[model samples]
Target: MQKNPGAKTIEGDLEEALFHAGAVPEQDRGCPKRFDWARSARTDKGVSAVGQVVSGRFYVDPPGLVQRLNSILPPQIRIFGYKRVTASFNAKKFCDRRRYVYLIPVFALDPSCHRDRESVLASLGSENELVKCLECSERGRKVEGIMGKRNFDSKIGLDVGKLESGISSNNQDAGTTEEKIKDFSLGANNGGFDIEKTEEDEVLVQDVNQEEVKAIKKSDFRYGEEERERFNRVLQYYQGTHNFHNFTTRTKAEDPAARRYIISFDAKTTVNVEGIEFVKCEVIGQSFMLHQIRKMIGLAVAIMRNIAPESLIETAFRQDVDINVPMAPEVGLYLDECFFSSYNQKWKDSHEELSMQTYAEEAEDFKMQYIYSHIASTEHKEGVVALWLHSLNYRNYPDLRFINNNVNNDVESLGIEAKDGEK
Candidate 1:
């Protein structure tokens, strides 16, 4: 239901599709159509959900209703289970906490720093190198726009320079090859395009270029022990109450609503998918600000890669810093689970008990067929993350204020809260 578009042309997400499928004809259906349809979490576009809950009222609640709903809806959108809740239930407010898992390819963290790894690891955030990486990328993009993209190699104070000269030269950046074609993509390689001429390419990601392309492969993108330890420590900082005003846009730093409670955040090197390994990050919290999770991961990756200092994360939490945080690719993020502790406790005590549990086996099957398959294919073939990295440089990493690349902007004319509510 999360990644798949609904059947109706009006609204295309799971929630919208469910409402349509559950909806009965106005005249024949009881009650006032679908009343109080609420979702536990509003997953962003392209995000998959294993445990998502929704509650609403229909005129009739007959036996096999769940089956009927699935029969009517798309197979990609399945109802794992359903529960009856009290009249006081408010899916948005009453819920206690939400948990999410973001699975990024381990290669994204591949130190891009070759032999100088020792020095880079020693001083992860020594001199704000990440700013250099971002700013340099910004300069390249601006040059590409103003000047011909042919001369897009804008490399001043690029963090990749920190690498050993030998390793730096041998490791050509894949992005440079993308510049040749009008539509740039990492997956666009091996498509009968002659990249042999693009070999002398400079300005790899963060101004890194590998002379020996075969020396590094997608499998080569990985995190070392030192990078893993430091990333985990940085993740710990995400917990507890903090002002994430900079993580999102439009909200003022002084606004009390900007303060959010994070219970825990952790990450580890995992090779869950075939031929690819990535840091699997999970964060649990009462709620998150818009684009909060993506930005958090982006900053962490920058620090881990030794492109930026660890202090950037701290400054982001502070109200005084006017930092427009950069976001990692949204393709890697997923809404893993949502918890309703208080609601479940109350229901247990009362005469009625709500079945808020999920069917894990079935849920896993659905995700593999519909969700993970798309992510893997897109990552391997289409180069979603690569395109997103390029996008970070778009508009010079402008403020992440309500940009919905997933839903067609054309739908905005229809007006159904396009990309509204939840990060």
Candidate 2:
């Protein structure tokens, strides 16, 4: 049986009802009751199920069993209803995909304090630290793991070229030109390259936004060149269908049971409305082993911290490799979403209706609490002003793109000059 953490209370209540109805024995009337012949699938605590299905044989009448179960279930964890499928139907085998959605607050600090004056001043100098700290927090780290696959050593860099290669290999001629066109469009919009043209009378040049250039320059937010290349190598090694046993944490005896699958991972950084920045990583896979995501996030964090050697990722990608690195924290992680080939229309419709109702109620309660908090804090205008000031500084800071570009150019040239000097 698969259990949902969020439904524990309701599950317990239902168990009691089942006991009363003689569906369960007196000794088996508790939350973690064990049935001698049944197998269990364990899931993390606090994880909720939306449309999970389970099957079993019972001596009691099916309709009566279901009705009794529903009667004791809490409104928060209601059973939407169920249907009988073919006798050969297997809930796990028939599942095409599983999706999870995680709601994350964009900015780390209190949203209201962002408008204060003192906050604005502090934000300008402390923005990077704040972002790093927030992301390093337990919840942030956990969410990062949920976003990707990684080696047991906890390395999480993605191989974009490898992903593209896999897709190409599968369909051969599929999406090649279309992918190039999309890439070109995105690159052009992001100012990835410059174009030169000459008119009949004179040469015209497109001007780059100095502020944008500065922002790009100031954003020292990615792996170093050598580190990035090593990461790419690791990704290339893992491309296509290959057993990921070595990349996962498991006992030697379990190696024979390990599986191979395809995975696509992407990472990018974006600035939010509040001027706070974040790194978002998305990973799609046929399936993943235990702790795969956590390990990957841990690797990424290590790379970001300049602690791990870049080649470590490549080594970890090898077959039967034993990567024993600490896994990253889980609080920052979220099972963002799942995908399936198709969904039941009626069930989907009902689920949407129920979700909307729940959200509406929650929204009303939140609004009331917010109003009360605002009124209670009215006298603390000084503190509020400080926070607002911090937010403003974040929004109005001068772009650092020019400085960054100059530094990068100088570094490159310095290397060239040094080589010549050595000669």
Candidate 3:
């Protein structure tokens, strides 16, 4: 029952609608005076929730209440139906498990979809050459922005002589792509949109270009069984409980909270949305931290693309190593369901079971109309996955490089120095 924070939120909208609907007393609206409002789960900005539940004391009339509230709320926010719970019921504490679904573009998992094969070859060539490629790629991005997008081939106009001379002169002082990624702040908030209403009408989100949009739609954008199997193998790494301190921010490896239990995580199937194909990944876990789900998806993509080795997943779970795991865009993530099995088992005789089954049809319709539609439209227009994959190549992970070297025998040909034991 607090003052609206200007930007629209589900809870904020609910509170306002309840007050206007006479479901809650106007006086009991904020701070100590407000009714206790608890949500089953909280999602970050731009993340949608389909089966989110809330509980609190309200002056509900029980008849026409859902319709009355729907009239006041926005099109995206809806009140399906309400249930009377026990006086001591708390939505947050009583919730046992949460399920989240991530819709990732097939191109993000299919290495063959990447347009910059030449850049990938150059990135693995030598340390200095990697730096040059990153710099040239940055410059090309700026130019692409100014002139709009023409063609991917036209953008790979690198001056070999000038780049070679520059690399020779600055080899000792050249910075890696890792430094550029930090400076550009690509990993912050895992690239989620921050919606703060300003004096001007604007929505802050990741920058997009027509070329990237065209790039995503240009190819068949389909993956074969081999690619699907690889993506699933990468996801399998996150199935068990692990120390995921590196997956999110601020939490240290020593902190007990850093460890999260993932009951299961898998790529369920490929979904065709409009013309683009998406890999539907479903994860069931006790809980997830900020940007945790997105980072999981990001790291999986990194492994699938060969930018990072599969073993890096195991290494990241260890306390000694702190990896800067990239975050996927927030558009595709949504809260699928919340479980209250314990409470239902205990209180079933007296009160109704706290389940979303009654509203399953409504939830699916809502997701199709609002959540899925938004994700598909955003991907088609913004090309969030393609752009994110491009930035990932700039990363120079030590373990990844080591694994690449071990697998490829042409280290000398690529200008990388052989180890003491190697020929």
User: Highest TM-score, which number?
Assistant: 3
TM-score order of candidates, top first: 3, 1, 2
Best prediction by lDDT: 3
The reply for model 3, stretches above 4 Å from the true place, is: 1-6, 115-221, 396-400, 404-423
Off by over 4 Å in 1: 1-34, 59-61, 113-221, 351-357, 387-423
Residue 397 displacement in candidate 1 (angstroms): 6.2
lDDT of 2 by residue, 1-423 (tens): 133455433234434554564555566555332432121111243222233333222234433444454455333333333333333333344344433222112222223222333333355665432222111112111111211122122322211110000000000111111110100000000001122322331222223355323322223333435534444443343345555554456534136545545455544332222222333444555555665555554454343333344444444444433445435433223333233333334346432211213233433332223221221122121122222223233223211011221322332332222222222
Q: Tally clashes: model 1.
A: 18
lDDT of 3 by residue, 1-423 (tens): 112366544566576777887666757864312556677777666677777777776665545656676677656666666666777777778889999899998868765454354554665656623212221233222122212233334323322111000000000111222110000000000112333423332222234465345433444446678777778888999988999998999898889999999998988587777766788999999999889999999888878876778876776676655567778888788888888899889988977677767767766767666677667666544455655666666443333443532333444442334444444
Q: If ranked by lDDT, best first, what sequence of candidates would result?
A: 3, 1, 2
TM-scores across all candidates? 0.64, 0.39, 0.72
Q: What lDDT does the true structure give each of the candidates?
A: 0.51, 0.32, 0.61
Q: Against the hidden true structure, what lDDT does model 3 obtain?
A: 0.61
How many clashing pairs does model 2 include? 43
Model 2 deviation from native, Cα RMSD in Å = 21.4
Off by over 4 Å in 2: 1-42, 46-51, 56-71, 74-81, 99-240, 246-248, 267-282, 309-311, 332-423
Q: What lDDT is reached at residue 224 by model 3?
A: 77
lDDT over C-alpha atoms for residue 202 of model 3: 24
Greater-lDDT candidate between 2 and 3:
3
